[model samples]
Target: MKRQIVTLPLSLMRVTSIDWDIDWRGAPEAGLTDGNTQVVMNQVPRWVGHLDMTMRDDWLRSWRAHRWQAQGRVGIYRLYMFDPLGFNLQAIVGRAVAETGIPFATGERFSSGSGFSPNVYLEAAAAASAGDTYVTVTCTDADLVPAPGQIMSAGDWPMGVVSVEANGDDTYTLGIQMPLRADMAAGDLVSCMATGLFEVDDDLAGAAPYGKLNRSAFSVSFREVLNR
Candidate 1:
């Protein structure tokens, strides 16, 4: 594949919130005689996203420069949005927890422990056809597992996690919010979706009071482009 697709940095996802929508094809139509109007709809859909982030004025300045470098409103940058529900993509502690405790003279004990879930790579375990809701995947990352509510992409097709079930053989079955859009093979990359890709095809406008005070002050618009 050509390197036409540019991946945005994860640091760009410091958004306070996002306003996402699906831009499906539609047209207003009216009966010639009665003048009754109706919206003619085509189910072809694309993602329309609005991002709001608070950052230093310098950062916002650089963002504007980046957009200018792209010739304004004509750039394809791959963006990855984070999961809304916290810890849904984080590592889950196993059924056991090991802690070392020491008794103190104050009648209080000190127990120190640690649990962290860093980013890890993932892949599918079997070939799956388009329209399949769940796909089996294997993760070599120890103590870390994919969880429900995480949004990910496979073969460049976006999907959200609805369920995660373990198969007892070091593999997992993940139910996706949207079924596969195309067939995928075994060993294909099943990203946990910490990546970024945003195509700028619209105006980058926002009302950032005092540089970056309001929640929606610094906002950028992105439109998902599949074949643009």
Candidate 2:
């Protein structure tokens, strides 16, 4: 399977570390007269792993929004972990939640140059099947139709627009570079970043920036979902 790095937009707080721990529920067998250990295993033992990471409080509003939507409940998400040293990609499918409360932290402000906002959000209108070149996208107030040379990203796959057609009822069919890989359910958020745009830092002059630099960490405990 093609795997890409997972990015939680709200989890951009100070991510200090990613700690992964695994457990194997195996029972050790006792030895007889030799005083040595002997084990008899019929099947593989239960295996599990958890991912823990810390984030500062720089972007607490975004984190709060995420937490509110989650309702402090567990939900399954496709999380990607890349190991550069081993050249391995671990795409985990399991349930996750925010198990800790946000702590108040006083710190320096986070600063960055102004960035362009996305021209339009590519919202999937229906479940898209693989090998379908044309896709239906939600029409926004701008209703901007992508040009042939323009690029759009769905998840991690970036594709150029070959053609576009309005399907009516505030929806359009986009002929992309190729068909999609996995199916995209309706309302999946896809971004079309505004390329070649510049913005001045006019709003940063008098902002107090009450929140601390985002150091709020997110810890998710998950167990691999095994297929029957």
Full-model lDDT for every candidate? 0.59, 0.42
Per-residue accuracy of model 1 over 1-228 as CA lDDT, tens digit each? 333554443333557886654566577665566776667876445556787777545444544444555544455666655454522332342222211122354645322122221234577899999879998899766544777767677765666678989888889998975567669899988767533345775544433445234222467787666563
Instruction: Identify the candidate with maximal TM-score.
Output: 1
Candidate 2 lDDT by residue in tens digits, 52-156: 445434345544544344333232222232221211111111112111222224432223211211123568887787667777888664424455545555664
Give per-candidate clash totals: 10, 13
lDDT for 186 (candidate 2) = 91
Predicted candidate 1: what Cα RMSD to the true structure?
10.5
lDDT of 1 at 69: 53
Question: Each candidate: RMSD to true structure?
Answer: 10.5, 17.5
Worst 10 residues of 1 by lDDT: 93-102
Task: List where candidate 2 sits over 4 angstroms from the true fold.
Answer: 1-119, 194-228
